[model samples]
Target: MKLKFGFEEFILVFSISMFFFGYMRIKFTFMVIKVTDYYLYSYGNKGLLYCSLGLIALFTYFIIKYISKNVNTTR
Candidate 1:
């Protein structure tokens, strides 16, 4: 099947992919840090890790999307 899509479609897909990969990588790194910290603490608390990673991911995604939008806006 051959479906034609404009350049905007490609940019949108690329942006979404970047955001997803960024979030997953950040979340995975955060989990690893939590596990190591837990080992050292023995009685660890991981309450804010999720929130912290989520915020980071969100901010990063927004920044990336904004840049992509602006850089390609002229197109």
Candidate 2:
């Protein structure tokens, strides 16, 4: 027997992975902030926080765009 993998499966896996990745990033940012006393006190911590936020925004945009495109194509 052979198993088939397609775009939908890829998107499902990608979305789940990104979710966990984003969650861990945010958690790590909080941990850093706590250790550093605040986000403003260090450039490295601030950069890490911003980078994670940017990644989250990008992920959201891509996921929405993909879903919208698929929805339009299906109709």
Candidate 3:
């Protein structure tokens, strides 16, 4: 069956991509920063980190819910 791609699908894909990108950015940031500079780096990008975490959480929740709903419906 051919599935129709719509706004919700687009959003889900976008969110998933953004989640990975944010994860990689945070990982790289931590990897590049020295232990001694951790506090300074965190302080400078506190808001950005928080926002990334928030998006990650939100995306995870929605993704899980979506997958669960699909699984239940398919069964």
Candidate 4:
């Protein structure tokens, strides 16, 4: 089989990377919460969590929309 690279491939790679990055960010955020549960009370960790979650949601939405808009495969 031959290799082919194009816009669809680029979007696929980008979306996958974004998903992994978002997952890591969420995991790391929870780790931080666990590690700093005491001090996090004054440091607005909740705000950080909410912001990160919003960003992740937006990224997911954009990726889904892009994939749906660009998808041309019939099989």
Candidate 5:
């Protein structure tokens, strides 16, 4: 039998990437909160951090919504 890969698999992979980025963002946020001086010195401004996190989150949300819509249509 042949294996099939489609939208679900695509979403799964993309979701994993999103999760990894999200985790990194959270770790940086915690560092910023716990060690403001060092974190700021190392990472510069927080605006880029927040912006990247928001974009990743928004992309992931849209992917999830797309997956749900595809599933509903297939059924």
Candidate 6:
């Protein structure tokens, strides 16, 4: 059976997907930095990157959970 969704739900889903995409990209970047050799340790950049990833991860979790709970998909 086909299903329909409200505009608000669509926007929320879009936002959650975007956040997840960002988180994945950042994770990849960090992995590359850690694996690459011969480069000097960038402490400041590493610290900020870790902090930002944590913050974004937390936000993404909350956003998806809240959006899913709030959007009634039972049609």
Q: Which candidate wins on TM-score?
A: 3
Per-residue error (Å), model 5, residue 38: 9.0
- All candidates' TM-scores? 0.40, 0.44, 0.48, 0.46, 0.42, 0.41
Candidate with the larger TM-score of 2 and 3: 3
lDDT of 3: 0.67
Candidate 2: TM-score?
Answer: 0.44
Compute the lDDT of residue 6 as modeled in candidate 6. 71
Mark the 10 consecutive residues where model 3 has the least summed lDDT. Answer: 42-51
Give Cα-based local distance difference scores for all models: 0.56, 0.62, 0.67, 0.61, 0.64, 0.59
Model 6's alpha-carbon lDDT is: 0.59
True-structure RMSD for candidate 4: 6.6
Instruction: Give the per-residue lDDT of model 3 (tens digit) for 1-75.
Output: 889997666666766666666566666666666656767466447545654765766677688788989999999
Of 1 and 5, the candidate ahead on TM-score is 5
Please write out the lDDT profile of model 4 over residues 1-75, one tens digit for every residue.
Answer: 789987656655665665566555555656675655656554455545555655666677678776887785533
Given candidate 4, what's the lDDT at residue 70?
Answer: 77
- Which sections of candidate 3 miss by over 4 Å? 34-75
Q: What ordering of candidates by TM-score runs from best to worst? A: 3, 4, 2, 5, 6, 1
Candidate 4, residue 42: CA error in Å? 14
Q: Count of backbone clashes for each model?
A: 0, 0, 0, 0, 0, 0
Best by the lDDT measure: 3
For 1-75, candidate 5 gives per-residue lDDT tens digits of 777887756665665665566556666765666566766545533545544655676687687888989999999
Query: Which regions of candidate 5 fall more than 4 Å away from where they truly are?
Result: 1-44
- lDDT, candidate 4, equals 0.61
